[model samples]
Target: MTSPTTRSRTAAACMAVLLAGLAIGAAPAALAGTEDDAGLEQTVEAGEEVVTEDAVVTDGHVDVGPRFLDDEWTMLARDDREVPSVWRDPARTVLHLGDAAVLPAPDGPDYEFLGVEPGTPLHVVPQTQTPDVVWLGWNTQDPRVVDSVEQGATLRLDGLDGPGELFVFLQEGVTGPPNVLWDSGEPLPQELWMEVNTHVHANWVFTEPGIYRLDVTTLADLADGTQAEDESTLVFAVGQDTDPAQALAAVAADTTSDTASDTADEQTADGAASSDASPAADPATEVTDAPEAGAPSSDSGGSAMLVWGAALAAVVLLLVVVGRVLRARRARDAADQATGDAS
Candidate 1:
């Protein structure tokens, strides 16, 4: 018969082992390496692309995933020590707030002259000179902060509203946010935009067009320990009207009356016809077609699998530890009884 003392030791040992296993199991899901993991309990394993870390399905139901932007204004600071040689190297047109346009892209690289995927935010802003790249930028006032004009400034986009995702990126020369920015509270790899001067060119894409008001913030860390900060609102009039306020109202109404959903359906219904529709005679004229497909919501089975696997592994470890402890305890107890009997 096992003594109470032996039973107690065995119980304590099993509990300790089980607790240790659980601690290890929970650590990865809670800890984060990138901004995309900021809010998620996601455990990103090695070799996974950032964009693919979206909502996934576990068992026919879609599990929640990370987000690119917080629904409200999320302030991000750029601490890059290196500044570009020219703010606008191959001088492109300046964009102003209240500027609107259907972004142009030839679906290829050489973004400077060659249009890329229509995902750049800079294309729709009104600017100093007519931007060869974005038609709406021409005839629009430059919206950049005045003080930072000469010293150089790092451009960052702030705030968000409306439907669809905003994709901004640079292929060769630079790097910035390329994932879909939705209102959902998912983690962003880098919540802040890359530091850019007027010389910087990037790809900006918007899935839906209407009036979009984005707060643009510029920060330049000078040599003298002075931080130059400037901010302004950029209003985009996309699709039908040019009036920022009216455009806003139109989209708001659409959202309120469920017109955003309606518009999406209309676009889908006419996808074939719209696909065949010729490019706008004047690129400035707002063109409406099906928005490009982005990362579709998938099963979070990958993450779920990892989580469940960890849990199962932990349980297995606990059972193994418990079994080993019990066996050892029995051996010791048998030896102790044999010694007592022999004496």
Candidate 2:
């Protein structure tokens, strides 16, 4: 018969082996994937592997193109945990386009903010000398269960602050911005978006690290014949030096500053973002959707570079947590056995 200690050792060895196998299996998907090579005019054969790092941002701008291809979910649903106070709804509604809520999904993509807590902080995955990528998973929460969502709900991402074009994905959607219905007749151009119930995944690229905010607005027509529009402020911290609150305060100060030139420049940037055209002349803006040349561009490759990274990070974190739990349980079991043996 195997000694109890021997059995424990065997179990631990098996656990380590399990962890190794998981790592090996996941390494490729996590680290390698394809993106659109619009600038290169090269086609990534179906199932081609690529990396987002290849889409380098020179001069802190998104001028480079043959836009990257991505058909992946940056985060997925993980196991459930209780909500922390900071993450609970802030009682605000009416979100504009481009506004993103900063929530962590260090595990898998989140479902209704199910996998993360307020303090589940995130750093750029795959630690690098020049870390410009952030993988984020978020979900818009609607307490009102749709008895019947009459018109397909749409989420519009409109305004943006800071550099780099923002790309969001609906797990199964395309790599670029998700599909949207646009109308120039609106006060500002409009993008029709799929209404999100609990989770959305995205790859956030910041040509330069800083605080960024995208005004989010969601509108949906319900079965009750009432049109619902909710808007909220979503804050993001890009890199170690960013503070969302501080950025907001700075913008406020700049508003009342004597620097009229700075304000005009700001307006120009905002104007460019509101249009379908990209601020950069690079081919990245040459997407097929929206208005003609110089029109705002949106495309979806639905590739998997950032999706794998986020998934890998979540797996690693989950493994670590599981390992700790197993070790603690084994330690407790051994102690109990020792006491029983002594008795």
Writing each residue's lDDT as its tens digit, candidate 2 over 1-343 gives: 4433544444334322212222111122223233421111111122222222111111111100011124211111111111210122211111111212222322212321222232333232111111233222333232232233454455455666654334332222212122223222234434544433322332332333565555556555667786665553344455544554565464455446736878888999999878857465658667544567764334322345667788999999999999999999999999999999999
Which parts of model 1 are misplaced by more than 4 Å? 1-152, 173-198, 241-343
- Please give, for residues 134-200, the per-residue lDDT of candidate 1 as tens digits: 3111000012222223443444555655444455433321121122322222333223332222212
List per-prediction Cα lDDT, in the order shown: 0.35, 0.36
Q: Backbone collision count in every prediction?
A: 30, 47
| Error in Å for residue 267 of model 2 | 26
Weakest lDDT window of 10 consecutive positions for candidate 2 = 59-68
